[model samples]
Target: MDSLSEQQQQASEKPIINITGEKVALGPIRRDQVPLFYRWANDFNVLRTLHIPRPSTFEENLAFFERDVEDEKRRTVVHFTVYDRASLTPIGRVDLEEINHRDRRAEFGIEIGEPDYRGRGYGTEATRLMLDYAFTGLGLHNIGLYTWEYNLAAQAVYKKAGFREVGRRRQAKFMGGKLWDIIYMDCLSTEFVSPVLSKIMVPDEVRS
Candidate 1:
């Protein structure tokens, strides 16, 4: 196949958006996109920010995707493929893991694997949309995340999206010949005002 045709074919297979913001959209993880996920998993630049310690094989990523599907069915985790809104390009992923309905809490994680998309405000917007879904759509009360101290950029984004530093695990992560603290931050439903879900949750009668 010609390069242009292949590109067109790939474009047609883009995942449909589930949740959207001004700059980014969150969509279901498509089975066909496991290869893309596998690519991200092995990107050392991306892995440095995330908790992944070693390179992952394509088969391992496939197995992980299968397990992830089962977890979604059990409602133990919620994952989304992050897309660039303007181009509808798959750029990364975001997820709420370890969800406990009784406790009303979960752990948040995000990675903008596409180097081109890094440093943009997309991550911050995506974080807000996920928080809205957790607090309002899913009725989750608290969302927490852990970031290495070296990941100052992620910490800034989390703070912008309403998370506050609850505590820290000192010198927990060793990388680049140095030890970095693991920063724990969380956002409470009471402290956040959902940008999207709030409007949906309001009574129409009240508006009238």
Candidate 2:
């Protein structure tokens, strides 16, 4: 089969759901999905919101997959492929990186690479699910993320997921013929009530 057909076939298969949500599910990132990641990395619409905001080659994406595998093994990062729960189609990615178990904190990052999936509630659902995993599954106390000043949509999503704007780095990024601040937002385990993990982790007696 041709590459496009093969990708579609693979995507249609039932994915191993790690964290389920209302509108989306999180699954392990597969090696076969590197081509999709490459396409998203190169898409300007997606890249513009990312911290680096640069086109990535396929080889670089391959290298990223390899590195992600190692990082996951070392427990320094946790990555997931965001899937549309209804269609089971891969739409984006969300990850908690720079994990410090001792400090109980990590940096959060997410991208809805598929433009069709943007402006929907998928990203917010995915973020909440990740937060549940981070706080309850991994016992993390704090999770932080950054976004450019121009990305109002992302800020709203993060806020809806329990993150509050803590600060900003003034004129930290130059894009689209203007400089923008790097806005910082974060949420603590105390501030968030786990939507999924708590039920699984806590006993009925303690929960009541």
Residue 128, candidate 1: alpha-carbon lDDT: 95
Local distance difference test values of all predictions, in order: 0.91, 0.92
Score every model by TM-score.
0.90, 0.90
Candidate 1 on 1-208: residue-level lDDT in tens? 9999997687567667878789999999887789999999999887888875698899999999999999999999999999999999999899999999999999999988889998888889999999999999899999999999999899999999999999999999998899999999999999998887787776657553
Q: Tens digit of lDDT per residue, candidate 2, span 86-180?
A: 99899999999999999999999999999999998999999999999999999999999989999999999999999999999999999889999
Give candidate 2's whole-model lDDT. 0.92
Give candidate 1's root-mean-square deviation (CA, Å).
4.1
What is the Cα root-mean-square deviation between model 2 and the actual structure? 4.3
Q: C-alpha displacement of 81 in model 1, angstroms?
A: 0.6
Model 2 segments beyond 4 Å from truth? 1-12, 203-208
Worst 10 residues of 1 by lDDT: 199-208
The alpha-carbon lDDT assigned to residue 196 of candidate 1 equals 79
